[model samples]
Target: GQQVMQIPQYQHVQEGEDFTTYCNSSTTLSNIQWYKQRPGGHPVFLIQLVKSGEVKKQKRLTFQFGEAKKNSSLHITATQTTDVGTYFCAGPPDSGYSTLTFGKGTMLLVSP
Candidate 1:
């Protein structure tokens, strides 16, 4: 069995500050998924990274996959109240599967 390790467990940033969260897995992955869960809301799909060194961005948020496909990261620029939530990075626990094993999410707290 493999596990995904997410760092920090929690992050607090002031408005307009930057924040980053890292994810590492015990095994290589074919793809990874990012999700954002706002307070009192369910997780919402953000994006999927598949390439060895993939990078994607949505507005002020940037996502990256390590060249080895065993790690990933999410960076948010200029945090805001709208960005307050828990961000999760997940990957398939093994090959030939679509079900994902999620990290223990990095909770983001933005103070205005």
Candidate 2:
């Protein structure tokens, strides 16, 4: 079965630092999507990469698609207390939606 895996399920950072997370899939994916969920909030779309070896950035955050489209990563230049939340990497489902199957996610905790 095709499934995505993420490491360092949890992370803690101080204000004004930096953090990065990685994602991997057992099988190749057609596309991948990254989402963020703030505390007490629903998942929000951040960005999506379709082409192989694609990379995109939003402010201090950077997203990348692996050359094989089977892995992805998110990097935050600098951390902030408001950066506290869970970051998820979702890939196309093996069966339907072709949309994405979200990994458990990497939770970020920022301290003031």
Candidate 3:
């Protein structure tokens, strides 16, 4: 069976600090995708990395893919209230098809 793991079911940060969360899996994956859901909102695709050791960033947020493609991490620099959301890391099963196994996610809360 395939499984994905995410830590820190919740996170709290001030208006201007850094935050990070990690994800790992028991088996190798062809690719990994990230999604973010704002409070009372649906998950929206943020990014996808398919190559081993790939790294990508958007503004203050950075994403990394492990060499084995069995793990990944997301780092956010200079947090803002607008960044508040649940970050989900997901990967497809061996059978594939765009169907994803999602981690429970790390919920971020920011105080003004």
lDDT of each: 0.93, 0.89, 0.92
Report residue 101 deviation for candidate 1 (angstroms): 0.4
Clash tally, candidates in order? 0, 0, 0
Q: List the residue pairs that clash in candidate 2.
A: none
How far residue 82's Cα lies from its native spot in candidate 1, in Å, is 0.4
Best by TM-score: 1
Please write out the lDDT profile of model 2 over residues 12-93, one tens digit for every residue: 9888889999999988888889999999999999998888899999999999999988899999987888789999999885
Q: Residue 92 CA error for candidate 2 (Å)?
A: 0.4
Better of 1 and 3 by TM-score: 1
Per-residue error for 64 in candidate 1, Å, reads: 0.3
Ranking by lDDT: 1, 3, 2
- For all the candidates, what are their Cα RMSDs to the real structure? 1.0, 1.6, 1.2
lDDT per residue as tens, model 3, 1-112: 7899998899999989899999998888889999999999999999999999999999999999999899999999999999999999999854566678899999999888
Lowest summed lDDT over 10 consecutive residues: which window, candidate 2?
92-101
lDDT of 2 at 31: 85
- C-alpha displacement of 2 in model 2, angstroms? 1.6
For residues 1-112, write the lDDT of model 1, one tens digit per residue: 8799999899888999999999999988889999999889999999999998999999999999999999999999998899999999999854778778899999999999
Q: How high is the lDDT of residue 75 in model 3?
A: 95
Model 1: which ten-residue window has the lowest total lDDT? 92-101
